[model samples]
Target: MSSAFEVRGGNRLKGEIIPQGAKNEALQIISAVMLTSEKVTIHNIPDIVDVNLLIELLGDAGVKVNRISRDKCEFQADDIDLAYLQGADFKKKSGRLRGSVMIAGPLLARFGKALIPKPGGDKIGRRRLDTHIIGFEKLGARFNYESDDNYFRLEAPGGLKGTYMLLDEPSVTGTANIVMAAVLAQGTTTIYNAACEPYLQQLCKMLNSMGARISGVGSNLLTIEGVTSLGGCQHTMLPDMIEIGSFIGLAAMTQSELTIKNAGVESLGIIPEKFRSLGIQLEIKGNDIYIPSQETYEIQTFLDGSILTIADHPWPGFTPDLLSIVLVVATQAKGSVMIHQKMFESRLFFVDKLIDMGAQIVLCDPHRAVVIGLGRQHPLRGITMSSPDIRAGVSLLIAALSAEGKSTIQNIDQIDRGYQYIDERLRNLGADIKRV
Candidate 1:
């Protein structure tokens, strides 16, 4: 059964909240556990649906999973059932999860063969698997796609041989997948235009700890010296930067005072500044973010006095995931700003729902929108809406929390896939929200 959130808007939430572990990082790191047969322990795993489902999938594949706690688990893939990969159960479960694609790189590297169903996740835009498939082919893996059942079969009968490759785009998952596959190859592999997100860096660091030689972790160029095998290692995920960004936007939208605890500020790289550009005041004190309540905030124009435009780029640039949050927060600001969602075509479509809630917004195109701050002159009115994706779902929730009267948000499962105990956490911060 699907869930919905009934939100009574116009509540000034105030409290301290800790973000869950990084969701993107957890997916890569958990998948990396399969690269080693020895026991691997992961700490700070998010209790979200997607991560939990990946864990369950691993368990079903003959890996021994011991849950140390709600946020910690140990994985040992010593006796993986390779036959399960071709079974209906694996196809059905993996098809529902996009993260399941990452498992292919590890499985192919460690076991010489792997199969994956066409993965599924957010419908924000076109997410191509070309980077992954091409990288695997470069590493001596030949793959064939079964169009009938939407499955991919990859094999390296002679073992993988590493080679230099340049990615057309700096895709985070693509980089992680290629890097994981390259780690166990027979020779040196150099990857240019690789994604250098903090999560990716953490994956490299964890791989290094597990006896793999990887360098250029925090940069776009990565060099890996392939090892014959990898061992187990413990890794703790960084705090979710997307969630931290969401909290900052949430505090500003509801005119609430909120303190986000242990936000991993250094890894946030440019996220805090991006929120500040919208005139949201935030203080970074000892890795925590403090957002003060304000009756109104103004948007900052460019130095040349042009309308400020926020566009998504690869890491070190603003993340694409938080663009929805930024767009929603701008609805009540004091000036105009253009949100250029350059990465995904459909991300800006959610602005229509914001417009329905009395937000002053103009959908310029599929990839862009201009938001004219309401200046608090006219408060947004609550309305019923369906969440389009994970990021947009949270964006709508933020809008509903700041609007007048009550709002019903359907498809909250999308929200739960990314956020952990969101409604319960919001309740702790005095938000008048409940799950139905």
Candidate 2:
């Protein structure tokens, strides 16, 4: 049987934990390693299943992968086996991860041909690839989809040329793909309404270090001047903002005085403010967030005295990934809040598990839920439940830690894909949780 977390609830956790490296950022950076043939030493990589799987995929494609430490790895893509990318085994491996779609851009830019199987990931909603495909096509690439095989073939035989494109949405992965491809195209490429998240900025900076011309970073508009080739450069990942937010929610829900160290506060756009609206008080000291034990937190209403509505948006807004944590924290606040998960339809479905655990929540629809805080007036009863996805898994873990009696969380692999040694970390903070 797969591993499960056996959690004994009602413990006030203390001590400090550092946020791990960004999982989403690591995926993009690792894929960009294929853009250069030189040795790329990346530091602060997260130790997680999803990232480890991507490293394995790269090795299968003949990229030299060396693990120097638990959090550092070097990759050299000098001898990429293009034949392996079209094989059945490669298709099977790539299909298991959504991040695999990103490989198409680097491969196409370097070799002018790339194949991708239908990618798989968290079934949050309809995560379309049209943005990535459209961006590639705008750069003068011809794309063909083999419906029967459920795979994609992208080619730029004459070589890609830079052009202008305004993405329909600011998709993070889409932006990374187009940027990587544009870095080697024949001319200057302009991208409007681009994703300017810190991750994208870091990736852009890293590429520029390897001789790519990119301007207007940290904004919606980006300009990339193509280079004939790219060289290897060392890159470090930022702290995972989603993980920091999750820890904040966990500390508040369990009434624990916990401190999260090296949280990279500057990159955390609007996340702390969003948590503050939920009545969760966090003291930011330098790069650390301190959450003191509180008897109760009262949710704040809008300036118009209307009920607070916490929703997700693109970067510079509350991230959809952390909405699950927001909703879980609202269940213990002194007032009610409506959580509107704008990006993913099925993400709010995890409220059912919290509702079963004595949380007063009304699932208005697939994307919205109203949580009425019980204010620690009532203790939640523990129950066995399976994890649904990465974010929801951590949210459920937080709920379990605050509930009464013992709780068992199965399918912990879902959590393992995003969080690194979460059970052991929680245990370090005085949580009565054990991996069974």
Candidate 3:
């Protein structure tokens, strides 16, 4: 049954949830192995099913990976068994993972070429690789369709070179491809208007530490100077910002106070202010944030004092992935907030489940929803529903906890992809939930 999570709902959760390494960052960082043959040590790595699958994928392809500790690992790609990457079993397992697509550029970098099948992830919307493909093409790579096998063969004819490339959109995978390609190119490469999310920045940092010359670390304009080789470097992954954000929403929804440690507040620029518009109180303590239990909160309206709207953008703005969680948190606040998800057409469809639970939300369109914070409107009672994606599953979980009755969340595998043992972690904070 695709692995479901049955969450018994209607519990006030109060506890400390330690953040794990960022999944998005980990995927990219691990893929960087193709740039060198050194033994790379990554600390603060998240132990999740997806990352495990990625490691298995790496090991299956002949990379030596070892678990040095709970949050640390060692990777050496000197002996990748490229020939073994074929076959149905490999394709099937890789198809189950979204990050598998990320390996193309690295594999090409490591072995002059890559044969990759179509990758998979949450059924969010159309995720095209035109940007990624074009980036590779600009660097001397030629692509051909392997129609019978449902795969793409990208081969660098005379090796990669530095070039000026513009992405159609600030695609994260595209940026990663360019970053990996640039690491081994013969000259300098300039990427304009790239996706500069904190996770992406972390990847750049790790790559730079490994001897790749990359400038403009936290900006849209990235300048990478291709080096002949990169040595192994030790890097500690940052705490999961999404997890911190989730906790912020959780604390506000159930009127529970929480002090989140090592939230990397600098990396969360504008996020706090963004949450404040929804009346979420946050007290910053160096790198930590203290969320006080509140009895009443309201979403701020327009500057002229009209109903306000919160929307998603590429980066340095609201992440589209978090829009679902924002929708649920808005339901507990005491005002109205419009959620405009510009990227994905069907992301707002999940709100129908919220509505079924008596939430005061109006699905304005396929991409927009108006959430009227019910305060205590119909208090979500226990219900059973299937998780749709990674973020959606966790948002549903937070909503279920705020509801007054018992609820069971099916399809928990989605939640496991991003968050680590969410039920067990929340239970430590006083939540009433049992996964059966």
Candidate 4:
């Protein structure tokens, strides 16, 4: 059943909140469990819809899943039903999860064959699988797409042979997928222009612990020395940096004082600085981030006095995932700023909903939007809106919380896909929101 969030706006939420495990990291790490027959223990798994759905799919693949706790689990893929990969149920489930594609690399590497349905998630833009497919082909895997059921089949008849390849783009999932495949391939593999996000780094570290020989973890150029087999290992996920960034935006938007606990501050490269550039005052104490209630915040301009522009880049840069939060937070700041969403063309489309709520945002194009801050002088008035994607859903939720009147947000399932018990968490923080 579809649900909506009924938010009574203008509530200054206060209290501390801890972010869930990194969703992106959880997806990759959980999928890596398929690489070994031994038991792999994972900690800090997010109890979100998408992650849970992936776990369910894994269970259906004949993996032994022990639910150790809400945030932890153990997986043993010793008896995987390889035939299940081509079943109708697998197609239906995996097709709905974009992260399901990552499982192919592990399955192919371990079992010499894999099949994945056309994966789906947020309809942000054209998230191509070419990087993954091409990388696998370079590793000596034969690829075939069956249009009848929309499944991509990969087979390594003679097992995978490692080779050097440069990625066209530093796709996070693509890099992780290729790395997982190359880790068990025969001989050496060198990947240039690989994604070096903290989550990817975590995956590499975990794979190494499992006996996979991989080096150059935190750098774009990765060298993998293939090992005959991998063993079981325990890995813990970092706090979701995107969620941490969202909390900073939320505190600034509602003029609320919030402390985000166990934020994994060290791994959050450039996220804090990006939020700070928006003039949101935040203090890092130990591992927690303290954001004080602010009457108003201003946007920082460039050194040349030009209008500030916030754009997304690969790791070590502002993440594209949080650009929606940044755009929504910029709506009520004390200055004008340009939000350049270079990665996904449709990401900036959610600004129209904010504009309807009285935020002065100019939709320049599909990729860029100019936000003129209301400065809290003219507070936004609430209205009914629908969530288009996960990040945009949370962005709208933040805008609705800061608006003047009651706001109704439909399609809340999108929000639930990424956030773990978000409504309950916000309620604990004094937000006047409820599910309907």
Candidate 5:
């Protein structure tokens, strides 16, 4: 059986907490290591289950992996065997996480062919692979999806030649994959409507350090002049912004004066501002976020004095990944807010669990939830619940920390995939939480 968290609520947590390395960036950067055979040294990597699984998958493909430290590692892809990639065992390993789909770009760029099984991850909504597959096809690669076995095959026998293409949406992983592939193509490639998240910028900068000619570092339009090969380079990942956001919400809901150190405030786009809209007071002391304890916070209204709605969009907008935490935070605020999860259809369904914990939440639809804050007037009663996904699992954990009694949360494997030693970290903050 999977481990669960037994949380004793109503604890006032204090002290500083450090956010881990970005899980999303680690996946993309580690896959890019296969683009070169040189020793690629990476620092500040999150020691999370997902990242470890990706590393094991790379090892299965015959890449030389060395764990230099807990937060540091090196990769050498000199002996990458194509036969291992085509085997059933490799497919099973790749299917364990969604990041496996990213291997297709580097594999195809270097070997002219790639194969992948159906990617597995949180079933929040219809996350279509069309963006990735179609983008690869637009760049002169032939892609075939074997529906019988749910596998994908991509090939470019004549070698990829860079071309200009416009993406339907700014998909983060899609842009990373295409950019990685285009860097090794024969000619220049211009990608419009590309994702420009800080993680992508970091990836592009790291690629440039590896001798890949990529321009437009922080914009929707990217230009890449194909290079012959990529050399190894050193990379340091930014702190996980989602984890920082979670910590901020945790401090607010539990009414604790907590500080998040080295939060990479510059890279956190619109996240601090989004939480501030919920009337959560924040002090930015250099790179640290200090949330002071408060009895209650009032949700802000629109300039027209209407109810404020929080929704997700592309980068520079509030991320859909944090909407569940935002919903839980609203439960204790002084007013109401409508959380519209525009990207994922099933994410808001987790609100039913919150409602059972004494939160006044209305599940308007699978995509929307209206939360009316109880203003700390009535404390939430702890209850046993099962975590559905990563973000929702953490949100429910936060709720349990501020509830009236002890609560049990199951399916903690979902939580471990993204967070590194979360229970231990919370314990250091004076929270009575344990992994059972």
Candidate 6:
């Protein structure tokens, strides 16, 4: 995929969108199934490039990857041909996806120890893995970091033993690591202040299906009783809430009515409330969400009926990943709203693209931005734009497509990393998007 492009905006989207499975959750869940040498069958795995790439990487090192159905997969790591994970491309690709860190725990559990190269994903800011390291260390894993060598090696020479550990932050990846490692440990392991996001919860459920003992399904605390081995289990992936949120923003911005079937309403907990603040209506009927075409959604007023603020926090709070979509939607909203991206400092940098398209916004700092919506006041003329990160880039593409003309967004590779066949998927619902 080329890294650049031009966009002619101004198109209203109209259609029905069935959300895909969550990529983040699928990645971690697949890795977690490696606890035992047994066969694991998974369903609803998105047929995207990254998933294929991960499968290829695993296959080369000798893990059986098979297709049982369109969205189903059967995998077994009984024959791990390569004991040492040494390859530039593998390391680089592993670093690309958010779930790459998850394989660390599974690898250790299978091989007793493993070498991890520095991970790569969104360059929002310094995404720390200290919590993951500390949690593993508490389970009797020792680490050796080699800066010049670009290798981070760790080992559980005496095997991992269950221990109580607290996460410094509600990191999804860190929590996943601990969960994976503890499943095969010697005793009971407790994780406090852990990330209980839908993805994390999905991982736990998948692990349990594979015979791992876990308590506290959807809370900040987790209890895992180590098991000697695990066997294959059939599991389905959850709907992508982030993608659903993106579609809601797209529908609102383009005045396009859309039906998101089986939207995983249960996982959308406080997300709807956050989007509602921007006047985006997500009407639920059974498992579907109805986002009607509206010229401009109204932003909520404050307690004094002035103005309300929309900010991102940890899980159970508004997801920082969806804030980019919110910003794009706010441009067409009736009133002004503040967007606080407290998690990553560089996340707000992409606002410059929206600003260039004539959206009124002020970048307060690295982590804050105040958007004064145009309220259908001025039509946004499409212009050339490039995607910076996965979420922001796709949000920009949505904005560009929802604007006034034919828009071509570049750096689509980043967008493809998360959204599977986004152009085709959106086009099925009447969105005019094509990759050049």
At residue 82, what lDDT does model 5 achieve? 95
TM-score on alpha carbons, each prediction: 0.99, 0.99, 0.97, 0.99, 0.99, 0.96
Decoy 1 TM-score against native: 0.99
Please provide, for model 1 over 79-149, each residue's C-alpha lDDT reduced to its tens digit, 9 standing for 90 to 100. Answer: 99989976889999999999999999999898899887775999888888999999999999999999999
Model 1 worst lDDT run, 10 consecutive residues = 110-119
Cα-based lDDT for every prediction? 0.94, 0.93, 0.83, 0.94, 0.92, 0.82
Residue-level lDDT tens digits of model 5 in 284-337: 999999999987899999999999899998887788889999999999999999
Ranking of predictions according to lDDT = 1, 4, 2, 5, 3, 6
Q: Which residue pairs of candidate 5 clash?
A: none
Which of candidates 3 and 4 reaches a greater lDDT? 4
Whichever of 3 and 5 has more TM-score, that candidate is: 5
Clashing pairs in 1: none
Predicted structure 3: lDDT? 0.83
lDDT, model 1: 0.94
lDDT of 4 at 227: 97
Each model's number of backbone clashes? 0, 0, 9, 0, 0, 12
- Candidate 3 clashing pairs, residues 3+ apart or interchain: 4-411, 4-412, 5-412, 7-409, 9-407, 14-429, 15-429, 382-405, 382-406
User: Which ranges in model 2 have alpha carbons more than 4 Å from their true place?
Assistant: none
Off by over 4 Å in 5: none
Per-residue alpha-carbon lDDT of candidate 3 for residues 1-436, written as tens digits (9 for 90 to 100)? 5655555554555555668888888888888876778899989889888888888899888889888886899999888777777567777788788888788888777677876667577878877778888899998899997777667788986889889988889988789878888888889899998999988898899889888899998899999998888899888888888888888888888888888888888887667887788898989998889888888688988989878988888889888877888899999788898899999887777787788788988888889999989876557766788887889888998888888777778888888989888878888888887777
Q: In candidate 1, how many Å is residue 412 off?
A: 0.7
Model 4 per-residue lDDT tens digits across residues 45-78: 9999989999999999999999999899999999
The per-residue C-alpha lDDT of model 1 at residue 216 equals 92
Q: Assess the local accuracy of residue 214 in candidate 6 as a C-alpha lDDT between 0 and 100.
A: 96
